[model samples]
Target chain A: MYGPSIDRLITALRVMPGIGAKSAQRIALQLLERNRDGAAELAASLIDAVDKVGNCSSCRTLCEGERCTICSDSRRSAQQLCIVETPADLFAIEQAGGYSGHYFVLMGHLSPIDGIGPEEIGLPILEAKLASGEVDELILATNLTVEGETTAHYISSRARAAGVAVSRIAHGVPLGGELEYIDSNTLSLAMQSRKVI
Target chain B: MYGPSIDRLITALRVMPGIGAKSAQRIALQLLERNRDGAAELAASLIDAVDKVGNCSSCRTLCEGERCTICSDSRRSAQQLCIVETPADLFAIEQAGGYSGHYFVLMGHLSPIDGIGPEEIGLPILEAKLASGEVDELILATNLTVEGETTAHYISSRARAAGVAVSRIAHGVPLGGELEYIDSNTLSLAMQSRKVI
Candidate 1:
């Protein structure tokens, strides 16, 4: 057991994703022993980010301003809007460097069992944007999980009702992936979605 | 890419031990998305710990007051002093629940290449404690690394000069370790240090 403050620090650090008790202790001890300045800077950064950062009004992604960089960039296409479950997913797409469209972050998917519905994920705002007729195509870039598929299906119907074309990001064997190592579901999807050579 | 504050938070999170860039990003985003209150608490805890926690005047371990809990405990033996490389090592020994003596945390070992020496590890304070004649036995519980052994050897000589009985913690096969799976170095040490049954 450590001092009260150290114990509190270790407990607080466990709030981060994937960090457990031992790791929290290790991090706390490491900060206190070796990098107190770094610890102080991290504290300042966390406070600053928490105090200033909020969801982008347009895309619902975490940002310090009204609009995220991608949403505010005029060069990106207003015609195509990609829907993602989280800002991390949006970041992944951005890192891949293939998409030039703006993103709409759901922050989470529709989980009826968990009582997370359309309103919880700001679907009304998305529908309002769709109704404005600014977005001509809606790309569903949510994860490949069941919740993601269900969310995509629900949004696709909304987009169709709003007279906007909808498309889902394809899921199959990844680039440079060996078919022998790929799962049967993905293989089946790859077989079914085969296009003309 | 995320906004400036989000990016700064991610970068700052990387200051913790074992947290790389991707982990930092994941932690930052998870905190922002799911646990803003937890994030703020962690920030507050970090500031509180950094501002308040300092080395124990007696043992050189991180603590809030003039002395660490172990150093201030009157019931614990003053006749035995255990020297450890860091407060983490001291905590590990405490968690094992065997030792009941005071501790002197070195905070680090004799890392010569890094310009760390006796004063860097608070060896002078340890020597002063040894000279005080309160401790009859000195236990070396630093890590089993080269630097740790070097530090132990260096301190043992000092303790010997101060007329204190010294002993090193056993280095051998662990309690559940199988000889076939054990490393040759540990097995050799186990063989050499074998006690008559």
Candidate 2:
């Protein structure tokens, strides 16, 4: 019902995660609420973000430059490396706090049937980062999903072949999660992962 | 963690309708992706829209100028007025097409808990518009929600003594909706709205 420019902007925004028709309408209304300048600014920012913050050539984390801040920081422990499937996963871990080591962003998980392989998802870059012999411990912090597990297994083999210690993050009931709402799989995992104090 | 200014932008965008934590992060990232220009443009547009678009003095529809375009245009049917809850609703009606009449935007519904009353929400202005003698009929197009119905009844009773013909939009099955999937209330409405051959 709006002009094509407005429609295109709505369509472009809808491509993002969780946005549906009603939500898209709200966004379009918001842009209109801001008027021409607001619409233009949002449009410009979206295009700019799409072009600018890409995978770092080194650790593969998102960066504005060729090298991410983690890769650029010389004081960060090169001997400790945390590996993740995507930049988003790295961001999630960073938000959880106390991660001082460098990171290797795989850019994706290994979904072989979907044609997403180790080579396709920055695994080559990860291998090179490991091959430098600077990393003593490579932490496999991928998601608990099947794809994430497969990615971890692949990376663990690669890292261990290079004689580096590999460790997986604990998988169990999430913090503050109630037992009543917990699924069978997670409940079992929690029982299996029980620690002796 | 980044600068508080960036954090503020993320918080500000998070309050936006339909934007989730991830989308808010994406919006914030885009702001950084475009640097100062993006922030400046966003801020400028936000301030401008807030400052510029206000209710038309005559009719309550949103306007960038002293009066809305529909109010200013002599060609529009002043005798027929459509009432809606928000400027966003006006856009929705406009997109539905074929209704070329003036509009009154209530901006908010009759929420007693919110302490909203007639004078506070531009009902006096609506009464004046209706009493101007140029208007022939008043269209009650407020939403079907409880608050919307209350507001519609309030507006209807106010204009009843003035001899204005008021009618609601057809209550029936929404276009493209399956009868089996629709609620009983909607199905009943569809039955009641049956037409002659």
The positional error of residue A185 in candidate 2, measured at the CA in angstroms, is 1.3
Worst 10 residues of 2 chain A by lDDT: A1-10
User: Tens-digit lDDT track for model 2 on B18-110?
Assistant: 676777876665445334454554444444455455557877665667787778888788889899887778888888889998888887788
**How good is the docking of model 1, by CAPRI class?**
high
Q: How many residue pairs in model 1 have overlapping backbones?
A: 0
Which 10-residue window in model 2 chain B sums to the lowest lDDT? B1-10
At residue A140, candidate 1 shows an lDDT of 96
Share of true Cα-Cα contacts across chains kept by each model: 0.92, 0.03
What is candidate 2's lDDT per residue for A1-197, written digit by digit as tens?
43343444456555544667778767756656434554544444444454555557778665666787778888788788998876667778878989889988776689989998878778787778778888899998998999999989988998899888999998898899999999999999889889999
Clash counts per candidate, in order, are: 0, 0
